[model samples]
Target: MSEYEFSSDAALLDGDWVHRTLREHAYWAHDRSREVQDAANAGSRCFGVYERGTGRQVAFARVVTDGATFGWLADVIVDPERRGLGLGKLLVEGIVEELDALGLRRTLLMTRDAHTLYGRHGWEPAAPVGDWLVRWRH
Candidate 1:
């Protein structure tokens, strides 16, 4: 068993923690505003990884989906202090499993780095069709 609990419950998410982490560390969301993050969460399927004992969110990710054919994953971040414990892999794996259950035609995400992490979860560069099929098989 892992030390973290993964959840898709928006209610369990810590928006302030997410906002601050992304604002300070994430290259893509460094300048993103709270309003935008809130709105994004409101419209997307949000996922978080929490410390099992304290229920404190330690990681976050969200996917903008139509609940059918497509999903666009965004804002994937793990608390810097907790990075090497495999929390990121756990989070992304959970998200992929959730999406796979939806049976969506495609799920997409973009990253400037961390290719190795995503790749381990079956994500690939460009040509989303292959990536979708690859992830679906797992």
Candidate 2:
């Protein structure tokens, strides 16, 4: 098993790293402004995955939850340099465990290419493509 450690400490979140990774790499939030990113981090239950000894953040995920019945997982990203190290799976697993502790009955996430990863963690396609609706504002 990998030695990475997962944390739910918003204080441990490296905002600059999160912002840069999302802006430069993640397709979903590439256009998000730094202020918006900060706001989202502030509002969600942010998780940070760190190197075992260095304490450097290498992965991140967040959940917006009501602390009971519903959670929406978002912004799951691993450092590009650390991809294939199983940190993504570790991050997701940690998030799910936290959510389960909250007694959340439903958790949701949208991914363009990671269906298989999430499936292993008990997530299923909540709706078929074109059946879900969004009201994204720019």
Candidate whose lDDT is highest: 2
Q: What CA RMSD would candidate 1 show?
A: 6.2
Give the range of the ten consecutive residues with the poorest summed lDDT in model 1.
Answer: 129-138
Each candidate's TM vs. the true structure?
0.88, 0.92
How well is each residue in 7-35 modelled by candidate 1, as lDDT tens digits?
99899989899999999989988888999
What is the model-wide C-alpha lDDT for candidate 1?
0.90
Instruction: Write model 2 residue lDDT over 39-135, tens digit each, in one string.
Output: 9999899998998778899999889888889899999999999899889988988888889889999898989999999999999987677876889
Which runs in model 2 stand beyond 4 Å of their true positions?
128-132
RMSD in Å for all candidates: 6.2, 1.8
